[model samples]
Target: PGKDKGKDMILLTKMDKRPPNWTFVFAVDVARSGSVSADYSVAIGIAYNSISQEKQICYFWRSKGLKISEQAEEIAEISKNFNHPYLLVEQNNMGQDMIDELTDKYNVNVEAITTGAHTTGKNIKKEELIRFLISAFEHEKITIPRGDEYSREQMSILEDELTKFCAIPTPAGNELFQGVGAHDDCVIALALANRATQTVGIPFAVTLGPGRTQAGGVYSALLQATRGESDIEKMIKLGIIK
Candidate 1:
């Protein structure tokens, strides 16, 4: 139900549900709506084990001409469909307005990515975002599925953007990254999703540590089940991993 206008769309990987130890993160890059020539607002969903392994892109959506409230409602609906993922919305331009709508109207918990220098929380600069995405790709830590036409088209856009993405040196010695003849909407959304994988703010997921708490012990056991460590395979069968 993500389609609205002819250009607005959503795509999914059609994969089975993830294990309990896996965590889902969605990142959004907002753009001006109501104009075909305007930048497309994009959201990317990534699933990772929150321990060791690559992050998989399971969802892709882009749309234009949607109002701020409409965008927030779409995001909230997607979150519910994906088990209430840890969501990060870029806090720039219409992003702040969308964040407010999502939080207040939809009751969706969200974290804002400060686009500049900040003393608290996740403050991600543009350069950092690009570099983080590059690092993930370089380390082979990101998997983009191309199982279907929609997935293939999105991957092609990602490849095209990365190919034409250029860095221009500013007068102040900083570099600005943008596409030469393309939009960086998908690239920015991907970078934000990669950044989300590094954040440790998932309220429901249990982090590994030496602890005797019931939740911690259960999670540890579930992790062992994934490794075939012992008889702890029952943890997975019990559907307690997620």
Candidate 2:
């Protein structure tokens, strides 16, 4: 399907309320494709609990109809409306176009990261990012939302994309990971999000003033809402509280 990247190409999904110490980050693995040759998505994730570091949300914005610049504007708007996430853009190939639009034209807050020396000294490696994502899912450090009335039906589509990831052998005798389907924009973008949040350090919750204490009365309820129907306490029951 040749979808047009127009104003109509947008995504809306319900997200949980940000917790006290939630570190919000937005990452982009940019691509320009009018058809299904490739796909691009804007992914959002939140990391909490500085000690344990649990990722609470995994949401994506992708459309075949919208141009890269259009997608950049959409991501900027979403980030601004939802607590201004720390933006990360991969400047490889056509990715620079997305970076230019977000920084030069829109003048938004964004950080550009590339593989190898581009992310030098920061110890941010693509392999590490992918490993972190895999670990998050396997170890139950990441929890995905089931969406709500706004995107109840479309949420599964996004989640389905995650299942298509495959690892292939590279000429260098190392395994390269990617989506085997026409597009793996969601997986790549989410990996970037995890990397961004990881390198930036976990945001800690601070009080307003002296003697002021943070409220935990509704924390559990918020987690329930974020975790959907999952028994979040199972992790605690298993003595995995870190």
Candidate 3:
């Protein structure tokens, strides 16, 4: 739940080694650079206990102005540090290129989450993705990190983004999830991670109480990240979701 925020990157980690008895996954949202309006490329690591139902964010990396190749490299490196958790990348914008690069160049395993019209597999609509995250928060099934200045500021920024996230009616009568002048990259990235905790298959046994087997360990870091926009006012009025 802590970070070393650089000019173009932020990595939050508690230790170099992985934690005990946790399954991990990395979810990414890709964005191109150069334009001021361009969104940030974000990758989040989520850790969970299948039995205890303990889900928390363990790592975060967000950067702007990085090329697709650089982003792929960074993701590969960070995932390696986290024991090479399952990688889920949204197939939008520079997503295909990033996926190609990571698989071909870095030998990384990636599951593509479809978010566009042209998909041979199941597509994750914006509403569905947002709803997944909303359910997680509403049910208190997931948590983000707190404490420390950088972590606190990150949480504040994420909460602010959630508060600003709104659903807009489009000309086609469809709905669009927007941050309404704010950035939703973090929210999307975090949602992707959260989804991983729910959908990905666990390879190890998970039981309650002591003597349960430990799969792989994680750094002792709290969950930290953002959420999507839609009926955010209602969510805020309920508790602000911090």
Highest TM-score: which candidate?
A: 3
**C-alpha lDDT (0 to 100) for residue 43 of candidate 2:** 58
Which lDDT tens digits does candidate 1 get at residues 1-242? 11111122234533346676687889999995547778889999987776665577778888988888888888998988886778889888888898899989988868898767542566756765665565455444566666567767876766566656655667986656666765888888988887787774332223232211123354444544554222112322443311
What tens digits encode model 2's per-residue C-alpha lDDT throughout 50-146? 4677665545666656677677788777676656667888776667788788888777678877755333553345654555565454455555544
| Residues 10-123, model 3: lDDT tens digits | 235632343565688789999855354688888878777676655666677778888888888899888777767788999877888999999999988788888754323647
Please estimate how well model 2 matches the true structure, expressed as its whole-model Cα lDDT.
0.57
Instruction: For each candidate in turn, give its C-alpha RMSD to the true structure in angstroms.
Output: 13.4, 12.2, 9.9
Each candidate's TM vs. the true structure?
A: 0.73, 0.66, 0.74
Alpha-carbon local distance difference test for all models: 0.67, 0.57, 0.67
lDDT of 1 at 8: 28
Which pairs of residues clash in candidate 3, taking residues 3 or more apart in a chain or in different chains?
Answer: 18-217, 18-218, 19-217, 19-218, 20-217, 57-223, 144-223, 145-223, 145-224, 165-229
Selected candidate, larger lDDT, 2 vs 3: 3
lDDT of 2 at 71: 79
> Scored by Cα lDDT, where does model 3 land?
0.67
Candidate 3, residue 64: the lDDT equals 83
TM-score of 2: 0.66
